[model samples]
Target: MEAALSRLEARVLVYVMEHVPAAVGGRAVEIALDPDGPPAVFASAPLAPSPGAAVVFTLGRSGRRVVATLTDADPVIVGALLARVERAAPAGDPVRILPLAEPALVDAGRAGVALLPPSAGRWFPDLPDAIRFDAALVQVSMAVFLSPQELADAQAHGPAALLGAFGRGERDLIRFGARPR
Candidate 1:
């Protein structure tokens, strides 16, 4: 049944919609993962204030799903990042680093991707709703692409330290590839 198939994804989608009003009833674009594989449906919406700020997230993947807030919503780049997630994410591991060095990311100057647990009250505006989602035990992560040097820094100092650097600059988390200020 379609309901059964969407059980987990549906809940997460609901949480996204509730927090991201701009994404409510927004267009859902499906990017094919393979010639015969199920596509990843990205729920996308443009944020206000910043003309180019937008958020795109997957709603079809089971267990771990990826979300990113970027300067712009480029499907091609997002798709590439999602493909890397599919290939690199290890089972039972909450954190993942996906190596990516391509022309698409040249503008951002990021050579790798870090998938980290979304900070409470950062991605989800409603703490109560986020708490409820936590009860479900489904994991939704923020995808922040890092430069080679930054990736090495993370390796040396650890992901927590990297997150601390990002946290120091609140907006850095919302803007992918942004170096901590």
Candidate 2:
């Protein structure tokens, strides 16, 4: 079965497909909806090696959260990018490790939590649209917004605003101590 992803999540997938800093072993924009462990970071060269660090993110009714993380990571890249984020944390803030229950979860073209696999089409959370956005997008949206038509508009608009959000989100990953390359 395919993963169940929200419309915005789908758009973000496409956005990552387009804007990943680099692609080595494929543009790794690995995302976990509700992850665990040290945040991971993934991007391409000059910024990092191909597939920097897989990114883990999540959305919830209370709020949104994101972190860049890695299973095994590069020291130089980790030092350069994650240092800033780590500094922001209180000493001993544990790295949240997303449980990828299945290795297949991040396999080439997957999305969502470890328990669920990737699926086709837009996905709505198990909630009403009134306050339906996941935590990450909720934070990104910064305000209440959207409808089916608006979602289509956002999707069809070619990820521009989302890209801007992605940029900011990447910075957030750095802040969250996403381990590097």
Candidate 3:
């Protein structure tokens, strides 16, 4: 809640949205799935589905599912972002929380940062060796909204670009089992 975010957190959220909307994506929409209804469909558009920003839609589940995309989505940032989103969020759209680094990583593909899915390998390898892994990587998807889109765009370039641009690393923790069953 805005009441919880520190001044800096609020400033950063506003600044990023105003300057670079990607930090929060253009829009954060929640989808209401109907079991017998047509499959939920998102635009098959570019990452920046909108003219100048990205759009992210999460499945509106029951529990308060916390999806932190950045290491900085720490308490302050989380409180601030949630407060801001609560403005438009409906009752069923689970309040995505900002969990600690480890849990965030573990929840990465499970709709943590994305409604689609993430490869399990992305989180498996070095995570068990938490210290070294955390020291090397800085998760920003949750913190800066556009960071995830940027990471996705980086694939066309190379891993070096991602590391250089974000000052972080995301090597495969292991080589297998990154998909859901």
Candidate 4:
């Protein structure tokens, strides 16, 4: 029998597919995150300009679907990283960097994530509540892998500050194991 998606699952899939560029050849891939963990489907697509870089976002609604844009597009490496996020998602702030025990894909092991609010010319969060999804559209967070020192900097100053450093340096935020400095 064919499996059907729940309402929330459908919404999460639509949201990610709509926001992620189609030019990257993004497509959903189903994978078992763990033997006992919940099932997950993640969208994977290559990022242009940066060779080997790719973006992957979950289609699951557990603790809100997560998006990871990394330098290594390998599913194994990305799955390992996502597994870490899945384990940590329910514990604290939904948007922040979490430390990874080992190097993820690239040289960096630290990972940072932030919610991506809806925007159309203007940020939807600034609009009236009725203008948006009643309970907020399927929430999604962008995850970026970072160096240990970079994670420390984000924890010290703030995620925004670390992101600013990337912007100022013209660094590719999706680059896995990237150290903005």
Model 2, 31-99: lDDT tens digits are: 222345433332322233424343222222122222223222343333223222322321221221122
Task: Count the clashes in each prediction.
Answer: 0, 26, 13, 1
| Top TM-score model | 1
- Give lDDT tens digits, candidate 4, residues 142-164: 56566667778777877776555
Candidate 3, residue 112: Cα displacement in angstroms equals 14
For every model shown, what is its TM-score relative to the native structure? 0.72, 0.25, 0.22, 0.66
Relative to the unseen true structure, what is the Cα RMSD of model 1? 4.7
Where model 2 places Cα greater than 4 Å from the true spot, the runs are 22-48, 51-62, 70-181
Instruction: Output the lDDT of residue 35, model 4.
Output: 85
Runs in model 4 lying further than 4 Å from the true structure: 1-4, 48-52, 90-94, 102-136, 166-169, 177-181
- Report the lDDT tens digits of candidate 1 across residue range 1-181: 0122256666766667566535333445656656776665556666544455566666536345445444454644664565446445633455666677666775677777777656622554431312234545544566777778878877777777666765665536554544457
lDDT of each: 0.57, 0.28, 0.27, 0.51
lDDT leader: 1
Candidate 3 on 68-117: residue-level lDDT in tens? 22222233323333323322232332212222223333344211121111
Candidate 1 Cα errors over 4 Å, as ranges: 1-7, 21-25, 60-62, 73-76, 120-136, 174-181
Ranking by lDDT: 1, 4, 2, 3
